[model samples]
Target: MHPAAQQAISTLLAEGKTPSVATVKAKLTEPLPMPVIIAALASYKNNPEAITHTAQQSQPAPAKPQSQLDRIEAKLDKLLALLEEKQ
Candidate 1:
């Protein structure tokens, strides 16, 4: 199913509204095929929590910051390069 369709279903559930093909289709920002909408709705009806879990898993993980030791090492490397150039 399309991500938008999944999101539409999730949104409808959150708003305490039942998700039918028409409702999900209407909620969608972009146009999708009737079959896709129907499939999504059926899947959602069968396993509501799966939809929410899938949506959460679909999100990209946050980037990790460089460690302080890594930063210090980089600075030391640069300083050594500068000294080598001077010599």
Candidate 2:
């Protein structure tokens, strides 16, 4: 299982939220592999308390280095440069 997926499950359990495969899938920013999700779900099922315990030990996620706007602007600039080069 991906670390992020494990962390998400851990956090959800800690928050007193009951997570399903669908709910965990919905919470992720990127698509995680099916096997990873299944494994995570199985881990939760086998040991619910483990997830909550790990959540308490884990550190908070770090802030993103670039915001959405910054990424969009960079992509637009590259596109404009390509267009200008073609002319």
Candidate 3:
């Protein structure tokens, strides 16, 4: 099961709502394919602990690297300089 779907299932279980295609879809931040959701539901049914396990195993989104941000800032600075030169 996709981590997102697993997380959604865990959340739904915690919320005391049954996890179904529509219900899970509603709980998710982004829409997932029906097949993936269905598979997740099957996985959950086969092993209820998987949801809890997945939730615990899930990692938070990593922050964007500072170097990448700096590169973008440098590009924007160059663009501004070019625009000023034209003016």
Best by lDDT: 1
Cα lDDT tens digits, model 1, 1-87, are 788798788778889999998899888856799999989988888898898898788864655655557778999999999999999
lDDT of 2 by residue, 1-87 (tens): 577687767656667888888878766655698788889899889988777677667766787755557878999999999999999
- How accurate locally, in lDDT, is each candidate? 0.84, 0.77, 0.81
Using all chains and alpha carbons, the TM-scores for the candidates as numbered come to 0.62, 0.62, 0.63
Which stretches of model 2 miss by more than 4 angstroms?
Answer: 61-87
The local lDDT score (0 to 100) that residue 7 gets in candidate 2 is 71
In candidate 2, list every pair of residues with a backbone clash: none
Among these predictions, the greatest TM-score belongs to: 3
Model 3, 49-74: lDDT tens per residue?
87787677775576653454687899
RMSD after CA superposition, every candidate: 12.8, 3.9, 7.6
Number of the candidate with higher TM-score, 1 or 3: 3
